[model samples]
Target: MNTATPWITGVRQICLAVEDCDATIRRYYDQVGIGPWAVWTPKLTNTKIRGKTQPYSLRVAMAWTGDFMWEVVQPLEGPSIFREFLDEHGEGVHHVLVETGTEDFDQVLAEATARGLPPIMEGSWEETDFAYLQSEHALKTNIEVLRRSPIFKGRPEPDYYYPFPPPQDSPE
Candidate 1:
């Protein structure tokens, strides 16, 4: 495997955009036996789209199925890439997340941006920083770059059900 990109270690998660969060989660559990998922509304403090700040919320459910993590995203409110995917493609795999080291985070981000894949969504939670690159045209799916501080150990245990915010009108 080409390891020119030293920052990127491997695939961390695969994200899907779904219309109904509950139904999708239930279906995955029944059909694929993937969950007991942990559902939560990601609180993105400083999100950007096309390099401009945009407010958005996503109702996301995550589960670890063997080696990789799987994520289901339901666009809850505001202008988001998940909403755009749902609008354009209905429902399908939206992105693939890659793990990067915190030490090389800036270089990785700079390289992605220089290659014309600007971030559509980016935020930092505790010690982890994540950015979703808008590379669907070239790569067929968005690329999410994640870098977590060494202090950040792992995700919380899966939760059965987490209350999500009510849906809101899409941004104009």
Candidate 2:
């Protein structure tokens, strides 16, 4: 019950900053039977690092096992919070994506800034906007909030499905 950020309704995803996303995905599947990961590299637009426009890339893999989503991100190019996290902490839990009940990312961003936990990295892909706030000092892990578009339902096809596609995606 963090009163500072009432916009956050619940935890939706837990993201791990990994050195190698595919290797980590393979290892997770081999060890814990977590597979069918959807992998993609998003073309982030209007990306900003500390209020300055700076571009970066990541190989991101996501998998859902019931209601919770797991995300692994490998920093691909340029400067990013993910890269900094790896340099400072190695591979580990970097951030948790929280569900913001509002569809307006600007409102969420404003609330976070007013709370003194400004975003270190923020960007948008298509109809979704995401912000990674600098909250490690207070919360131990960075906090990420996203405003997902209502028009978009179901997963946008990943670049590839790891280990193999799910039964629903399997070819006849």
Candidate 3:
């Protein structure tokens, strides 16, 4: 953790924005043996970007590479941070996520907000609440703060899926 921000535990995950998630996963598996990959389409509700509520969906795959997890995100539908990264920078590393206790999640957000780094995206995934700080200007990529609920124990083995569920109503 940086001395400036002690709330952050450490770099938990590194996310890449990919145009083809399957191909990327396959390449990583065959070339680097990064699998087995857990692939799913995340259903993010009550989403917000720059403080305005937005609804979005993303096809994501996760695989463990030693201590840190690697994530590949393919934006499926709706406006999303992944789509924005792809549009602006094509396919590449999008963000570095840091883990924090659920108890300190709000405080981390408050500290970031106080420093004029408002979240570019904020939403919940399963039992985790995540916020992506718009830190590209200073850090060359976004910074994601994650707070995992007890239900989200740790990474599981690869499980592939198509569309997770029917789309929800778009944000107003």
Candidate 4:
């Protein structure tokens, strides 16, 4: 007695990791050129992936583009997605996000699984309804011409790369 939910939305943003966040921002603000601040969250970084050289001081930048927003993420330290891109591509466009419309995120997740698109995170965001398809599966989606952008831009770009001096309290 299970029912499946349907889609009701599309991509809202595509995040990318850059080498020089300021430079990247200027390029868009000065080059591609868009507009006057819509809404942006403060720098919220501080996630590390151990055994990496993230610099622990990254930044995330975003701006409106046409009908969607272009987000740029600059990793501060360790070997984050940003660093991965810099090491290979040297900074640029990243992944495209398809906003979930169906409330039955679980249904969608199941669908993706059926399609061989297993997920990585499902704690809350990747629940039964809203989930991200592995990079390979995203490409195979065949929904559009280009394959899914890549896994680099799936997550939101943080404001800072790492936490400062550690929180006042640690698990005691």
Candidate 5:
């Protein structure tokens, strides 16, 4: 059903969620050989879900794995559907967001809605217009991906920080 360029751009970033960002980053950092990562956490944003006010912070550790950016996220102080995902399953790949270019950002979102893919997530407010909609078959996937504004393209490649080492003694 996806013929026209659905969003502003194309598939740009891939995100993963982990129970332990430090260990996961370390795994990619040491074991996986992905390094030089960057850590970013967004401030709390208020979103309405099921007619209730929800607050949440988008916490994540991002790194470039070859061409795609691998993001590990943890929901801090909020009621994120992502958190609900953890409760249902576990931390893992959440979403595959396709960058919709900046121009006619509103049109992209409107198109999604008009085309019948109401966005589960957007870059900013509902009025700003630019946003992304999750796939109709998202529930049957390994993760959930939401795209942001396409202003940032060719996101600098990140590094995997996993440099495998000795096994630390477990805390007893």
Candidate 6:
């Protein structure tokens, strides 16, 4: 029973690495009504693979159900962990993201690495920073640390919105 501060905390987003993000979002919508999905092809900055900076791209869809978020990621360009997951596991739950606020991001990441769960991928979308940790062997899934910008709640003007976007006049 180790009470020492845990490496990861506050699981916020569950991400799936998929073959086709749009198709998955549509399936979830048609079958279960899990969406009104927001889709984006973000300009990722400072992307890294296992600590070495590199380039990669992804097609991402996000939908909020109740209090949690479901993210579907399709690797567009790779050498990324997402691509690795798909190659190995054939489209499945890839990671669970930790919602540590910006203030604690560095400290939390430092602690996680110190505890031997170092980041395999690191990148930024808009102002938000994120990292994927090597927690596969121990937790059976990768763990992500997310540092969100106060200005970004979610994509307001997404590249595409499935099941139709909300009316501009309506106050969602």
Identify the candidate with maximal lDDT.
Answer: 2
Candidate 2 contains a number of clashing pairs equal to: 0
lDDT of 2 by residue, 1-172 (tens): 2454466779988999999999999999989997778898988887999889999999999887777888999999999999999999999999999987744678777778878889999898877878899899888999998776777565567899888877684321
Model 3 TM-score is: 0.82
Stretches of candidate 6 above 4 Å error?
1-3, 101-103, 150-156, 166-172
Q: Rank all candidate structures by their lDDT, best first, as comma-separated numbers.
A: 2, 6, 3, 1, 5, 4
**lDDT per residue (tens digit) for residues 1-172 in model 4:** 1235434258776766676666666656566554322222333232223322223434555555556766666767444444655686766655565655533455555565565555532212111122335443356321211122224334343333221221323210
| Superposed model 3: Cα runs more than 4 Å off | 1-7, 101-103, 151-172
* Over 4 Å off, model 1: 1-8, 101-103, 156-172
Per-residue error (Å), model 2, residue 118: 0.8
Q: Estimate each model's TM-score.
A: 0.82, 0.90, 0.82, 0.52, 0.64, 0.88
Q: Which model is ahead, 2 or 5, in terms of TM-score?
A: 2
The candidate, 2 or 4, that scores higher on TM-score is: 2
Largest TM-score belongs to which candidate?
A: 2
Better of 3 and 5 by lDDT: 3
> lDDT of each structure?
0.76, 0.85, 0.77, 0.45, 0.53, 0.82
User: In candidate 3, what residue range of length 10 has the lowest lDDT sum?
Assistant: 163-172
Model 3, 29-142: lDDT tens per residue?
A: 888766666797766766888899988888888766566788899998888889988898899999999866544777778778777667889998777788999888987888
lDDT tens digits, residue span 1-172, model 1 = 1235555667978999998988998888888777657787756676777778888887888766666788999998889888889899999999999876554777777777777777878876657788998799998999998777889865433334523221232110
lDDT score, residue 58, model 4? 46
Residue 33's lDDT in candidate 2 = 90
How much does candidate 5 score in TM-score? Answer: 0.64
